[model samples]
Target chain A: MSAMAARSPFRTDGTWLLVGPAVIFLMLFFIYPFGYGFWLSFNPAEGAWSANYQKFFSDEHLWRTLIVTFQLSLPVTILNVGLALPIAFQLRRKTRYQRWVTTLLVIPITLGTVLIAEGMLTYFGPRGWLSQFLQLLHIYDGPIRLTHNFTGVVLSLVISGFPFAFLLTLSYVTGIDPTLARAAATLGAGPWDQFRHIYLPLLAPGLAITFCLAFVQAFSVFPSAVLVGAPSGPTRVISLAAYEAAFEQYDYSMASAVAMIMGFAQLIVVVAVLGLRRGLYRGPVGGGKG
Target chain B: MSAPSERRHWFYSVWSGLLLGLMAFFILNIGLMVAAVVTNSFGRRWLGTWLPEGYTTQWYAAAWKEFQLGDVLWVTAEVVLVVVALSIIIGVPAAYALARRQFRGKQLVMLLFILPLIIPPITYGIPMATVMYQAHLGGTLSGVILSNLVPALPFVILVMTPFIEQIDPTLESAARVFGANTLRIFWHVLIPLLMPGILAASLLVLVRTIAMFELTFLTAGPDSQTLVVALYYAVFAAGVRAPQSVDAMAMVYMAATLVWLLIALRFVNPTQLVSRVKEQPAH
Candidate 1:
């Protein structure tokens, strides 16, 4: 295969040129904007180069957005990954129902967060079906205050984030050779033992990556944060702050600062997860020790 | 396989049952939420009821007129199609290279492509929009397209790489042996083999671009808003518009996504929905 690939005129000749456009495009669009934003964050309007950073750190109101965002993202990420891990493990083997379940889950994912927020507003509202159903069943009497609060944002995140977490987790879970589990079983391992001794070690690295991916998605909770969250109160996430800074205040420098801070916060979590993943098994994933 | 003893069987059944119950509850909640939106959109008065007081299509009409659905849909179609076409045009060849060639700094190049996928858009979008504004492209259709391509382009590369890797390079060599040049081998041989992948990437990008909110939201002006962004405005805009009308607009947005989603699902495995991009290594 390697020889064929090398002999093929397509690969040996100016195949490198084929990569040029994408590299140039990403450099122009993705990298340039990132560097530009970093630089712009320092050059604020009406003060020193550190003005935006100084203002952000000094203001309890501004920096508090970080904690609020973490509060929302952390629990949501943990919950999505936590619930998805076992379910994906159980469904790792092919089943007739897996397709239907995945298809159903894809509905919320494709529908996107904006529609979910809209649905949550009406469905979780005081007069919505959930409240009505709860009342009818005498489960609770008062209006369920799920919308326009911290809980609302969390619920919206799970609704959208869980399917994503599940799909990714399922892909990782299924990628493991099933014969590994069968081999473990033959060694008199129970389900829990198989999971703990066999699957978990192999899965540790993938789960860490999954956690980071899900964390990044949860961290940037914008549309749902605004539509379902109280944009001014407890649910005032950092992205919302950045949006306000850019569009409402027309301070691109302040917005850039907030965005940079957001990126920095997310990077901390990703790096930590990846660092931990390095200490895991990291052996052959296809069912061999060597 | 041997039959499990009663105790082990019992334990397994109970555990599976509990997980199934949880999944069922989640699916039910989602179903109800969507039903609530659809019901309210056609409802006369839905206050505290299992169903609406009466059904009518007036809200859809009202939403269409009030939200200017025609223009927003046109913009969304234009943006999504162009992004899909441009990303594929710019991405497939790169994927082919990454698949077939081993080179210096290839790992760095792979990392560059993956960065845009794992990083949250809003974090980068703010600065990207700032750059776009300075370039005099922000608030224009071109700005929206460029911002979205930041993610869509890389996604195309990541997805197509694996698909391209799977095709036997011997075929390309055979085409080369026949004196077909690189471009012809790609055009006549590789493309026909890659149709499934291209279709999958295009349709998934189509659905995603329509649903993509942050980049579009950050750079879009009133004229450039896509359907999802427009739906956000309808919900977020300070106004006295009826809830039903907004729900109606939400339904319109939902219908657009659902149609493409169902079609995309036929071509795309649900497990591949996220494109398995992170784990692929440059060989």
Candidate 2:
């Protein structure tokens, strides 16, 4: 025990040897590329001052995708967070099914957006299962409009986002001791009352954080939008705009500009959400600080 | 918390029922969609019907032939294996240094790891692709591997840090007192102790790398495309392939990921991930 003070306060030698490889690799590939992208956005090939940014903002079509992207992302964020809260609340008990239930709910997260899009096209397509079931029940005469539009994109986002939201929400919900709720109950706090006064305040910070995360995820959506939604129509989000600008239009600067816009939009909303969290009644941080 | 003596409002029961219904709806939705894909892949003809008319194995065979899936699967394996192996070699030691050491700039380094994770890959993928293209490395397999390594290595470090932190340092010190050098101690003492953590971390990296699309989509050449990228082309590219074949290809991608997912789940609970564990689940 006395020798503990004799050892170097930090680590034995070879600490750099351990951490150096990751630092070098990420600095070159991840950090450098990011800085390069930012630099490239500002320094365009044969352009005037901030031409790409100006061009992106000036073009009505390119900038509008930001609005369109938000429209889709906001609702999906609300639905995912809103739905996740109650479900996570309900599942906070130490029931035997908790492990399996949590595992099953998060299955879609592993499935990825592309696979979900594939499933949606089949289950929601004109000749897909949902349409056939509805038709057989005489719900409508014509085929249902599912994919190739806003509806399919939102649905896919929820399918992917809800699980993640639930996981976060559950961790927050479980972090609070059940005894607190019981204490509130003995004091005549009903479920709604307990939730509003106790759970909501504590969960608010986590919820705000969760919404920001889910919103960013939906905001950056590209695969599902292209795979299941009409790219030329209502579902033309910013990522797609960026992809086209880079890959299709062969305009790297414009693409980087759009990409920067996407990152900025996400950052603004995240900061706002976090700002709201700051003003709220902060509850105890629990679970894994995951 | 359920109280038998308490009387509940009618609305409470209905609310509880609705919540249950929502969970059921999601479960059924996921199951039905997966079932639809699986069945459609095997169905001989799936027109406007609740179930496919009949089933066969032809589509799997057809998808394999039409998509050049043999090559695609080979590429997928190559990319996933290289990323996982390299991530471990680099990340585990970093995790060790982090778990055992306290030093200046440690918090900053941790935040650096978190940044790649919190930010969407597309925000950075485009720029990376631009750099690769300019350097004539964009379409190469090495480019794809390096780009994917950005997130994978950070993920490895973050996940392994906690795992390493849990093991006692005294054991390593005891080994050191016995005259074991760094290499011998790491091989004989540290490796066995860290084996489970290593397995979980590796499997997670494998699953993640296989399903990762954004970076791979950006950097992969035609020959280096993984199955997910190939599936995207099969759907959106200049082709009018059979629906069954596409479904089969999607199924293959799904299976490839799901198997690794299942194995990873066995080693690590997904719930225990993304956040550190404060308490284990109560039975």
Candidate 3:
């Protein structure tokens, strides 16, 4: 390929010419923006100082918002992974039902967060069918108030995020050789024993990676928060707080601070999850090394 | 012994049933969302019912006439086309080099490509907007196209790398040995074989660029507003002059995206598109 490109009438330097411009383009657009964000986080305005950082830490609402962000993220991550595992296993069987289910599940990924929130409003919201049915049954008298609260926000996050986790887990599960499970079964292992001994251990790494990926995705929740309702009580995630600070309050300094904190928190969580996975691998290998 | 085998069979059946049940639940959840979107688009303001009381094509009509949906659709198509074309022009060769050639800073180059995927858009948008504004690119179609290159470039490279790697080097060597020269080899040999990957990458880039909201929202001005940005403004800033209008606009947006996705789907392999780019040594 290199030799062919060198001899081409389009010029031998085609590769460099084609690749260099895009690389430089990304450097200017992607790299510079990231560096600028980091610099803004520290500089806080005209001078190089930690005032934004200090203020972010000192402000009570910042901490509360951070906690709320975690509150929304942690549970959604757990639920998405928990739900994805069984679906992934069944998908490995490759039944006709699995194909239809996989296609149906992927619809949300294509649907933007705004659209998903809108759908939730019409279907799961107070005035929507779910609430109406509950009321008709006398389970509740008033609107269910699913939107504008922790439950609504988390549910939105979970619904939107579950597909991604499930797809990733499904791919990982399918990648594992089925022979291992069959071997375990033939060795007089019960179904539960075969799963616990052969399957879960192999799946642990993929699950850990999926957990972090899902957490990052859920952590960056934005349009859903705004469209569903402002993250006031339990829904006010860090991204919402950052956007509000920057756009609504016109406090770029504070906004940058919140964004920095959010990024840092996500990095920590990802690193910790990855670290735990590494720790798992470094442990004494049981009878099943593969 | 027979009793124990029967009991085990029953347990497995129940377990499989539960798995199938969960799968059904997931399918129903998504099915309901799609149904709600379609129904709400045409449904009369049906309160206190599982299904709409009445349906009409009025929303579609209003979307086309009152909303200026055609203009917004054109803008979205134009942006996606330019972004995808520019990305392919820049990405395919770079991916070929990264995959087929050994060079310095290869790892760093690959890392730089993947950077956009790592950082959240919110982190990049503010500074990107600020930079683009200073560069006189902000609020223009050019600005949106340029900012979009960050994600599009990485995606193309990631998708194209593996495709390029899978191309056997022997064919290129044979072309060279026959004195066909390099450009001829690339044009006749490499490009044709890599057509599927390129098409897939182009389609993926187009789909992504059209659906993008945050970067366009931050960088695009009123004059250059894409469909998604327009929909956002209509929903949030412009009070639904008619609530049904919002539904109409959303239906248009969804239909437009689905069409683009379907068109793009024909050119790309779904499995290969999702994986990231990794460098392999050339023999």
Interface RMSD computed for candidate 3 is what? 5.2
Best by lDDT: 1
Tens digit of per-residue lDDT, candidate 2, span B59-173: 9999999999999999999999999999999999888878887655567778777788888888889988988898888988988888888999999898888777777889989
The TM-score, computed over Cα atoms with residue i paired to residue i, of candidate 1 is 0.95
Query: Can you give the lDDT of residue B168 in candidate 3?
Result: 95
Q: Higher-lDDT candidate among 1 and 3?
A: 1
Off by over 4 Å in 1: A1-12, A280-290, B1-9, B277-283
Residue B122's lDDT in candidate 2 = 87
Which residue pairs come into collision in candidate 1? none
In the predicted model 2, the residue pairs found to clash are A288-B276, A290-B274, A290-B275
Global lDDT of each model?
Answer: 0.88, 0.84, 0.73
- Candidate 3 lDDT by residue in tens digits, A1-290: 34453464335445565568867888889878667767777877654488887877778777777888787889889999998887687567656665566565655766667667767766776667678778889999888988766777777887788887887787677667676777666667766676677768888877887898888888887777766766565666777777777768766666767777888899999999989888877544333333
The DockQ-derived docking category for candidate 1 is medium
- After superposition, which runs of candidate 2 have C-alpha atoms over 4 Å from their true positions? A1-12, A282-290, B1-7, B272-283
**Candidates arranged by lDDT, highest first:** 1, 2, 3
